[model samples]
Target: MTDHTPHTNHDSNRPAPDQPRASRRGVMKAIGAGAAAATLGIAGISPAAATPDVSLPTDEFVETDGTEFVIDGEPVYFNGANNFWITDDDANAATEERVDAVFDLFDELGINLVRIWAHGEAKEGELVLQPEPGVYNEAALEHHDYVIEAARERGMKLIVALVDNWDHEGGMLQYAEWADAESRYEFYTMDETREMYRNHVETILTRENSYSGLEWRDDPTIAMWELANEPRLEQDDVPNDMDDLEPPEHQEILGEWIQEMSAYIKDLDDNHLVSTGSEGHYYGHWEDDYPDDDWDGQDYLEHHSYDTIDAASFHLYPDHWGDNPADPDDRLSLHDGADYITERVEDAHNELGIPAYLGEFNVNLYDHDLETRNEFLEEWYDAADAVDCNAVIPWQVVLEDTQDHDGFQLYASDSGSIIEDYAEVVAEKSGDWDGDNGNGDEETIAVGEYNTTDTTSDGLHNDFTGDGETTHDDVTAFFENLEDDGVQDNPEAFDFAENDELGFTDVVELLRQV
Candidate 1:
């Protein structure tokens, strides 16, 4: 229960459900009034029929329960997208419309979670969240407020990161300049800069949402707060005009900062969860590509162990991180990306016993064709699921109108299909992720108001590829096979829609399980 020095060795890590799932038309009832009952020791899950007893977080926010994320006693497996420009504060009349459009697209795609930046520091001449220390821009704040309210209206949960490591919209560099720190690294260490940073955090935590009439700190729609995006220790980030600090010491310093900042945010807002938004670089895991290198300050296990932190987040850009040649372009292979994801997720979800999220990932289409990128994405998605990691949020899924940045932009038109497919995969297992917390405990009884659906079937799997596991390839194969005689004659076997017919909806449910 303690976040500080939390001991995470679960009784045994819950292995990903291996049994193929059988889907019925709808969820069975009486989940709370289980034919039997058991508990996860939290306060809220009730055994009563109306209450549907299951473990709940101490509060009604998206919370970490070991490797699962639960809300109102239901496990949430989200297919998410990120858009850093949502709060750009463009000062245009269309900003609110832009926010609505983005949320509308997310809803259309079944995306339940989104990651957006909360920090937009002042630049030479630009709109920003904080124009000066202890000062904020209402226009900028309005744009952000609208995003929160719009997401609330659309039933979306958000992960709002406090700052950025990059200087895209004046990140740590701007903070360093604001406080006149000797270096950007001082943003993490200098007392004055630290206070400024905390002041910004407080400003956000205490602000009243102009649109929602709800305090930012109390909104359940805001699922989690990230300390920063892709934060790195001075040692690893030395290339970015930072002076090299000593080894391990830099890690310790950043670790202390994460400890302090996470606790600080938790104190200001206990209604939501907190995470270290690190790219969770793993050293000494795989000898070849993942050699013993301190590429990022994120020692995954150590940083995520902070008691108040609820989730462990990492990003994947194999095109950027791969050292050896796995593909024709000498990039990291699909297997390399898979191993990287598995190690980090297992460490956080299994070893640290927190939900592991791939907060940003993309296979570059600039380097390869979209087909190649799609193929790699499937391998990575299965890798995360292979370790029971719930969410894999791609970097920068933007509206077709938004400008694509960093060659990682995923426009709704091109990559939106991937998001829809991922959502369907998790949706197919709707109630299965609930109390099956990998504790190896057969809930003594199923006597709750919920958690009553049975998804696993003997042989009726959507594993269309026959790869022995369901994955994105199956999604493709199911579509490709629609013209085959077997599929034409027996559409019922592929009826994911449960309408006794086969269609695109059925294909969306494939490649979900591997």
Candidate 2:
């Protein structure tokens, strides 16, 4: 009965099951002896019982760079939790009651997005089996259903990661053999393995739940399919024992294969969106061509940043890669973490020309180094908002007692500040659209009759117009319309005009506001 899992900030508010039944005496007092006959009917009605929830529509989903999920022309945000509960740990069981409690907490938090891991490796005993057709694992599949159903009940959205290369003891590279013909890990570059991954994805997309009796392929519950969790350039551990390396050739080949599979997944289940799991620390791997590679079929760019993410991700953290380099200025004392992250984010907008997300971030609550973690996150939130960055998904919510402690989960002693901090920030950042005057300063961009769902040029939200690829002028036109209609909304609507060149950063600011 000893708790093995790393304690998260599970408190009185920790997600728990719905109201427990009254005592047996009280139940008997109310129902009397007639309850026996009613129990017979409970079975038939239980599965068919109607619940207050909405299912996502089946159709190609469009998530904009500004973090909008447009399904059949409507916009939504995926505000959910990061559930890595399905791993083969002692605590790795997903019960319906536990799932229900998590869902209830999400609902309470007004969260609509959920991040679930779809680890692709098989396991031998408790150890992970590289490329072992993990899809065949019954427990894994069962947990998947439990998670999906829970999200459905809350009318939440999902960001599904196809592979979890970052978490297990060995990391994704350890499973490279499963990917390699010579190794135990199944590599996607291999046609057979790729096909299997594709088939498995197809199964998830097409499979209907015996519980909800609904298929997720067409539902909004699916936000996007992330290609891998922190996919890297190397198929094996790095040369210097460092986490990253520039495996251009390997990444190029792997990127192409991933793109093909991405396209394949999209083709088979056009209803939902598809993307890669957060790219982890390998920022150099992504390029302008990255999106065109097919893996970028969707609008969102999911990336991870800690203290190192000064450029692309607006979120900052306590430290960067490697042993913390001593800041000569002791910059840690200035709370300039937000500025650092924003500076990098701005550069990315100017360089890459796409909106980015600080997809995952959090401080280990149990870390004896709690103060550093807390201070780091405080500035991160400010930086995320200061630069108008996309979204932030903290590390995790709850931990199961069945799991061993690893310093990741947030226990009741730790999570209070972060949970409340994030909640407040999300609320305050909620506002009207604004325009970006590309030179760097943000301005008020009016909301015009831009139909994000339409393929017309000149519309604020149109990426493809009949005239050609959508242009900034088209976005400007939308703003003009909005201004004319007195609907000029958030300042995130307008693009910055640099010698008359309009770009997506401006549009994303506007779109995010929308």
lDDT of 2 by residue, 273-307 (tens): 55555332322324433312333122222232111
lDDT for model 2, please: 0.45
User: How far in Å is the alpha carbon of 7 misplaced in model 1?
Assistant: 46
List candidate 1 stretches off by more than 4 Å: 1-60, 92-94, 124-126, 236-243, 283-292, 323-331, 431-514
lDDT score of residue 44 within candidate 2? 17
In model 2, the Cα lDDT at residue 491 comes to: 24
Identify the candidate with maximal TM-score: 1
Give candidate 2 regions above 4 Å deviation. Answer: 1-62, 65-80, 86-92, 124-135, 166-188, 235-247, 280-320, 325-355, 365-368, 399-404, 427-514
Lowest summed lDDT across 10 adjacent residues in model 2 is found at 432-441
* Cα-based lDDT at residue 276, candidate 1: 84
Predicted candidate 1 versus true structure: per-residue lDDT over 262-297, tens digit per residue = 999978887888998888765332233442355445
